[model samples]
Target chain A: MTVTDEYLSNNADYAAEFSGPLPLPPSRNVAVLACMDARLDVYRILGLKDGEAHVIRNAGGVVTDDEIRSLAISQRLLGTKEIILIHHTDCGMLTFSDDDFKRGIQDEIGIKPTWSAEAFPDLEEDVRQSLRRIENNPFVTKTESLRGFVFDVATGKLNEVTAS
Target chain B: MTVTDEYLSNNADYAAEFSGPLPLPPSRNVAVLACMDARLDVYRILGLKDGEAHVIRNAGGVVTDDEIRSLAISQRLLGTKEIILIHHTDCGMLTFSDDDFKRGIQDEIGIKPTWSAEAFPDLEEDVRQSLRRIENNPFVTKTESLRGFVFDVATGKLNEVTAS
Candidate 1:
C-alpha cells in the first residue's frame, strides 16, 4: 500500500488490522500542557481524537524544567507552534502544601520526594506564574505561542488566567 | 505593580496570589494529546512546561472525533505546529477487552460505562496502530508535525514506534 493510505483512512483497526506506518502530513501540529486531575477528562471535555495534539500532564498543570525539554523537542524537532496551559479549579493537589503532598506520597508509597512541599496553593496564581515562567524561560519555543487558563472543576468551563 | 516588575523578579506564588479576571497572552500556543496511563508521565518523560503545549488525555490515546475539535481550536485560536504521540507498555487499560472493562466499571463503580471499551492487546502493535490512526485523522492540524513512540514501561525509555 502507498504511504498516503495509512493516515487517510479510518475503516481499519490500527491495532489488529492496519499494517503500514502512517504518512505524516507536511505540517506542524499543536501541543497542550494540562493537569493530571482525574476529573478534568481533557479528552472528553476538549473533544479530541487520536494523533491530533500532544498532551502534557503534571500536578496542577504547572510548568516545570522537564516540561520545557519536551516542549523544546516538540518545537525544534516536531515543529509545534502553540501551547495551552490548562489548570483547573479545586484540584486535589491544590488543597495541600507541597510538603503536605510529599507527606501524602510518603504515606501512600513510602518513598522520599523530590519536589518542593509548598506547591501552588492557588490554582489561578499557579496559572499566572506558569505563564510568565514559560515566557521568560530560555528553553521555551520562542517562535511558538503560549496561553494559560483555569478550568472549573465543577462546571465544564474555562476562565482565562494569563496571556503572553 | 507594573507588568514588568511583577513578572521579572518575583516569579510569584500564583496559587494563592493571583486574582481573578487576569490578563492573557496574545500568542496562540500549540496543543498536544497523549495517554492517561500512569506510567507515561508526559511532562517527566517529554520534558515539557506550562504555556508550551495543550494536552489531551484518554485511555489508549486513541483518536476520537472530539479530539479533532480541540485540535481545531488549537489551530484556529491557538498556534500549534506539531504533535507528539506517546504510548507506554504494561498499561492496565490494555489488560481487558471492552466488554470486561465496561462490566468491571458497572460492577465496581455502579455506573454505566460512558465510553468505548475497545482494548489494545499489545504494546508494539498498539503504538504502530496509533501512528496510523493519527496520521489519517481528518481534524488534525493538516500542517502540523506528528510523531509517535513506544515507551518502555519497565526501562523508562521511548523508542520511535513508527519508523516513517
Candidate 2:
C-alpha cells in the first residue's frame, strides 16, 4: 500500500471518533499564518480546537502576495477578522541566502525561478516584517488586531513581537 | 490580556511537558501541501508525528509559485524527497470566483489585486493539476513519488486521486 492508502486506512481509525459539522467561519474569527516547520503544532501551541481558527502556513511564514490573497478571502468571504503571524527559531529558511539558493537551482535546473525563497536572518524581525506586510496590505480587512510571534522550537515557548 | 497573551500562557502549560530535539529532516522524507481550512487536521489525517513531514498549507493548497519555491528548498536544502498535495471537499476556494472576490476588494479598498485567488470549480481536477505542476517543475527534485488526495471534511476520509 502507498502512504496515502495507509493514511486512508489510518483515517478510518480517526473517522471512527470523528464528530464534525464544523462551521465554515472559525470560532475565534482569527487566521494564523505560520511556518511549515514540523515541530510547531499550531493547534497544540495555541490550544486551538478543530474549528477555532484558519491556519495558513508556508516555508517561513512570510506574508507573501499569495498569503495576502488567502487572508483576503479569509477576512472578506469567511469572516475572519484577526491575524496571527508566527515564525519560529531554528527555521530552515535561516539556513540559506536567496541568491545562493537561486544560483544552486540555476546550476541544477538550467533556469532560474522568478520567485524568492523569502528567507530571513532573524526570526523576530521576520515576524515583525510579516505583521507589517499584513497591516499595510489594502486587501486585508482586519489589520488592527494583527499579532506577531516567534515560537522557540527548543523550549516550545511563544514570545510576542511588540509592534514598532 | 490579548488572545496572544492567553496563548502564551497556554503554551507555558504545554511547554512544561515539551520534549523535543526533533530532527531537521523529516523522518518520513515527505512534504504535504494542504488547505488552510480550519477543520482539516493534516497530521491526524495522515498520522504524521512531530518530526515526520513538512506540511505546507495555503488557502486552497494550490501549487502557487511560492509553494514551488518552498518545495525546492524542501528537496534541495532539506532532505525531503516526496510530496503529497491534498485539496479537500467543501473548500472555500469553491465558494467564489476570482473576479467576484477582486471586485469585492476593489469596492472595499479601491484597488484590484493582480494575484488570482487560485480558486477552482472541481476538487479532483485541482489535485491532478497540482500534481502535474510538481511533476513538470524542473526545480523540484524527487518528482517520482508525488501523490494527490482529497480529504473529506465531513467524513474524515482521504480519497487518493490517481495520477493520469
Candidate 3:
C-alpha cells in the first residue's frame, strides 16, 4: 500500500476519536512559521493544542513572499498577534547553495528557477533575518510579540536566537 | 508573560523526555502541503511519527513558487516521493476574494501587496488546482503518487478530492 493509503487508514482512527470543529480564529492569538523538517513537530514542541495557533511551514522556514502572504492573512483577518519563527539544526537548506541547487536543476531540465532557494549557512543569522523581515514588512503590522528560535534536533530543545 | 514565553516553558518539558536526532531524510518518503489552519494538526491527523514526513504549510494550502521550491527540495534533496495536499473545511480563504483582501490592506496601508492573497471560492476545485499545479510543475519531477484532500473540521475526516 502507498504511505498515503496508510495515512488514510490512520485518519479513520483519528476521526473516530475526534472532537473538533474548533473556532476559526486562533485561540492563543499566535502564528508559528517553522521548517518542514520531518523531525520538528511544532505542535508537541510548543505544547500547542488544536486551534491554538496558526502554523505556517516551508523548506527552511524562511520568510519568502509566500510566508509574508500567510502572515498577512494570519494577523490581518484572523486576529493572530504573536509570531514565532523556527529554524532547526541540520536543515537541508544549509546543505546546499542556491546557485548549485538551481544549476543542478537547470542541468537536468534545461531551465533554471527564478525564485531564491533561500539557503543560509548560518542558522541563527537566518532566524534573525526572518525576524527582521517580519519586523520591517508593511503588511504584517499586528504584532505584540515576535521571536525566533533554532530547534536542536538532538535534544529537541528550542534555543532562542536574538537579533545581532 | 507573552505566549511565546509560555511555549518556551513547554519546550523545556518536551526536551526533558526528548529522543536523539533521527535521520535527516523522511522515513516515509512523503511530503504534506496543508493550510496554515489552527485546527488541523497534520501530524496527528495522519498519525505521523517524528522524522517520517516533511510537512509544508501556508495560507490556503495553495501552490505557489515557494511551494514549488519546497517540493523540489523535498523530492530532490530529501527523497520524498509522495505528495499530499490538504485544505480544510471552514477555511478563511473561502471567506473573501483576493481583490477584497488586497483592497483592505491597501486601505489600511498606502502600499498594497504585490503578491496574490490566493483566496479560493471552492474547496474541492482549489484542491484540484493544487494537485494540477504539482502535476504540471517542471521542478518537482520525482513524484510517485500525488493526491489532494479536503479535511472536514467537524468530523476530522479527510475526504479525498479526485480530479474531475
Candidate 4:
C-alpha cells in the first residue's frame, strides 16, 4: 500500500480517540524551531502535549528568512511568546558544505540553487547563531527569553547553549 | 518558572525512558512536510514510530527553497524516497496578505524582509501548488510518488488532493 493509504487507516484509528477542537493559540505560548531529523521526537523530547506548542522544523533548525516569517506569524498572529531553537548532535546538516552541495545539485539536476544549505561545522556555534538571529529580530517579541539547545541523538541528552 | 525550565525538568523525566540509537535514515523511507499547527500530532495521526519518518514543518507547510534543501538532504544523504505534504484548514497563512505583512514588519522592525510568507487563499489550491513544486523540482527524485493532503482541523479528517 502507498504510505498515504496506511496513514489514512492509521488516522482513522487515531480519530477514534481524537480530541479537539483545540484552541488556535498554543497552551504554552511557545514555538519550537528544530531540525527534521528522524531521531529527534520533539513532542516526546520536550514533553509537549498535542496542543501545547508550535513545532517548526527545517534543516539544521537555522533561522532563515522564511523561518523568521513563520516565527513572526507564530508571535503576531498566534499568541506564541517564547521561541526555542533546537539543533542536534550528529545532524545531517553538519556533514556537508554549502559549496559542495550546490555543486552536487548542479551536477545532478543542471540547476544551481541560489539558496545555501545553511550547513555548519560546529554544532553549538550554529545553535548560538540561530539563537542570536531570533533574539536580534525586532519583530520577535520577548527577546529576553530566547534559548538555544543542542540534542544528542545517541544518548538523548540536551545541552543548552548560553548566548555568547 | 520559564517554559525552558519546565521543559528541562520534563525532559529529564522523558530521557529516563528514552530508547535509541535509532537509524539515521527513516525506516519507512518517507519525509513528511506539514504545518507547525499545535493541533496536528503528526506521529500519532500517521501511526509513525520514532525513527520511521522525517517530519519537516513550518508555518503553513508551504514548500520553500529551504524545504527543497532539506528534502534534498533527506533523499540524497538519507534514504527517504517518498514525500507527503499536509496543509490543514484554518491556517494562519490564509489570514494575511504578503504586502500587509511586509508593511507591518517594516513598520515594526524598520527592515523589510525580502521574503514571502507563502500564504494562500485556498487550502486545497495551496496543497496542489506545494505538490506541484515537489513534482517539478529536478533536485527531488522520485516525484512520481508524491502526495498532498489537507487535514481538517476540526474533524480530524485528511482528504487527499488529486493534482489538477
Which of the numbered candidates is closest to the native, going by highest lDDT? 3
DockQ for each numbered candidate = 0.03, 0.69, 0.94, 0.70
**lDDT of every model, 2 decimals:** 0.52, 0.84, 0.96, 0.84
lDDT of each residue in B1-164, candidate 1, tens digit only: 32223222222233233334321211224344666543344444443433345565554565544444344434433456566666666554465576764564456547544556436787667766666765665444343566666655545556666644
**lDDT (Cα) of model 3:** 0.96
Supply candidate 1's per-residue lDDT for A42: 47
User: Candidate 2 or 3, higher DockQ?
Assistant: 3
lDDT of 2: 0.84
Query: In DockQ, how does model 3 score against the reference complex?
Result: 0.94
Tens digits of per-residue lDDT for model 3, A20-39: 78999999999999999999
Docking class of 3: high
Model 1: chain A TM-score against the true structure = 0.74
Clashing residue pairs, candidate 4?
A: none
Best by TM-score: 3
Q: Tens digit of lDDT per residue, candidate 3, span B83-145?
A: 999999999999999999999999998898999999999999999999999899899999999
* Candidate 2 docking classification: medium
Candidate topping DockQ: 3
- lDDT order, best first, reads 3, 4, 2, 1
